[model samples]
Target: MKTMKMIAIPAAVLALAGCATTPGPDELRTNAIAMMKASFKERGQAKLDRIDQDDMQRLCSEYVGEKVMPKEIAQSLEKAQQALIKYPADGKLLGDWKLGERIAQSGVGKQYSDDPKKPAGGNCYACHQLTKEEVSYGTIGPSLYNFAKVRGYGEQIQRYAYGKVYNSQAFSACSSMPRFGHAGILTEEQLRHVVALLMSPDSPVNK
Candidate 1:
């Protein structure tokens, strides 16, 4: 009887193990989330909530280039981002190019070691070629040198430039560019300066 019981127990364990297959989509997602939570630690101004993916991010990750999101869905997302842009109450869209140059060069703030009280950089140069003199600029985005000269420093261009910087998603639904103003990474004043860096005739980017 003891020998028969042992054999039956082994058979039952093997059968249960054989029944297991790949994790379901929900289970995979849950496991991925758990792994992320376990990997990150809150420090300084950064918190665990920062690891949480928003609806947009989750959808972007899930679909990516595998499928095209509906036109209405894309338009709605862009519209939402456009509505969030906080234009200056004074209606002035430009700022000092010299001051803007410094802001563009300084890529500090937002890191655990960074001082939140200090202003952050747009890091545009890290992803774009904004000035002909700056040979070390990145190419993640198109070159902005002579931006005003080529695109024309017209009202429409100015507004588009400002809007693009304020919330990139307004132009491209899922642009790689950081939503500088919308993300609160750059303030309205700072945005105006960066726009000037790209649009001002006297700015190096225009030269």
Candidate 2:
């Protein structure tokens, strides 16, 4: 009886140790999310819900430390995102490039202090060299100078620009660019204007 009891005691200890050593993916994800949620409170327009990851966001988060995502996974994510893009009702994809320039320059929305009633800014200049005149710009994204001149002004290019601006993830999975239209950061008209800013030959971007 004593020999049998000793063996069972060690087996029980080993089982307990095994449980303590490994946490599954779901548990780790849940714990991480809970910790993140506890770190911040809702501030005005920025609510706690923003912390919750959608399907694409969660997959992107899973591949964070990797240098490149798996091709199959990336393609799947892009396909899903592409389906979600909402194009303008009218066939017209371009709006006033002048107005588009303003939206691109302004960075005055989506903050706690910013007025909710006012429109959000695309802040395009912050990341891309949109015009030759704007010397100070971020290198995070590629230069957009002579965008239409390089890409060519055409219906297909215009459609690609509009879709990309609406949801960058639709083209590139886990892109740093915001899903402007998908996230409701930009309205349909605002998206059209931004597309014009990139596609219009008369716009400074193309000049």
Candidate 3:
């Protein structure tokens, strides 16, 4: 009885110490960021600054994993992102679908090893299935096969497609899709090309 009592007392004391010293949310976040910074060494164009989170990104992180942000906050964020969208000045929302297919197929840019001078690819297949011919594709996003056939190849849909590609956060808050235009990942012409890929009837995506 004496030996068991002594062990129990030390175990209880250690439990209390652990509870007292447990880190709070803010402290835990700081510690996690510090750890990430330590391990992510800068290489080529990929700098340590990539670890930095903007206001939107920080809030998204806080609300992830079953703790969805309030609808109001999400809508406000989406509105702010929408305001950042820059439509084409010429009022044209499409380019060559052929070029668009090339951009969508090529995944040759933005990595640490990629040349910054070269144009980046949309890599649409990495997330969304764009055509029925593609036997292998990621299922992370909805299949875009027959995009224009289902949605109708109208000016309105074209504009929406262009804007969504430019800044997906505008349409869907905290979307995983990259802000191709807003982030300068894709040029204005490239944005148009991608729109053509989805909106053009001749494109395999619409076929």
Candidate 4:
């Protein structure tokens, strides 16, 4: 009985295999996207639209595995991203570092459950060491404990800091850092505050 059952299964499998073809990369990609779309239920501000990748994002995805992003492409992408940074017209990049610290510590905002009426958070502590006093912090990115101190508190550095927080991809293509200002995840004032957290001499990050 067992031998007959085993033989029957392979015969059924062979019959099924003969009728079906393997999916290619494009088909597989389409299927995967469809599966992902079906898997996550849309709710609140988080809709199925989040699954849609922008052109730059799709381009970045192409070279994600076992492939190097070309230097020319990377430079061009960085230039394009740099162009997206809109500086405050007043020419002031600094804000209240104290408020900035609060924003960094708060991980609230930008979730399906989060209240969109409230201002979003930078959540910098989730990926950076912003101060020497922190006993715990994330290390996904570099430690920015002495950001301004190490980089120097200058206009150029300040501009770089604001641009970086606004759109990190401006400096590094395919960076995992969120484009707070560029994406409108954080307001312009919030971007300035976060920049102050990194660039202000009075900031604990500099202390």
User: Tens digits of per-residue lDDT for model 3 on 97-148?
Assistant: 9999988887888889999999999988888899989887888889999999
Instruction: Provide the lDDT at 146 for model 4.
Output: 91
lDDT of 2 by residue, 42-84 (tens): 8899888988789899888878664568999999999999999
Error of 2 at 175 (Å): 0.5
Error of 1 at 129 (Å): 0.6
Residue runs of model 3 more than 4 Å from their true location after superposition: 1-20
> What tens digits encode model 1's per-residue C-alpha lDDT throughout 115-161?
98988888878888878778787888888789899999987898888
Summing lDDT over every window of 10 consecutive residues in candidate 3, give the lowest-scoring window: 102-111
CA lDDT of each prediction against the hidden true structure = 0.83, 0.91, 0.91, 0.90
Could you report the Cα RMSD, in angstroms, for every candidate shown?
3.5, 4.9, 2.3, 2.3
lDDT-superior candidate, 1 or 2? 2
TM-score, cand. 1: 0.86
State the lDDT at 110 in candidate 3: 81
lDDT of 3: 0.91
Give the 10-residue window scoring lowest on summed lDDT in candidate 2.
59-68
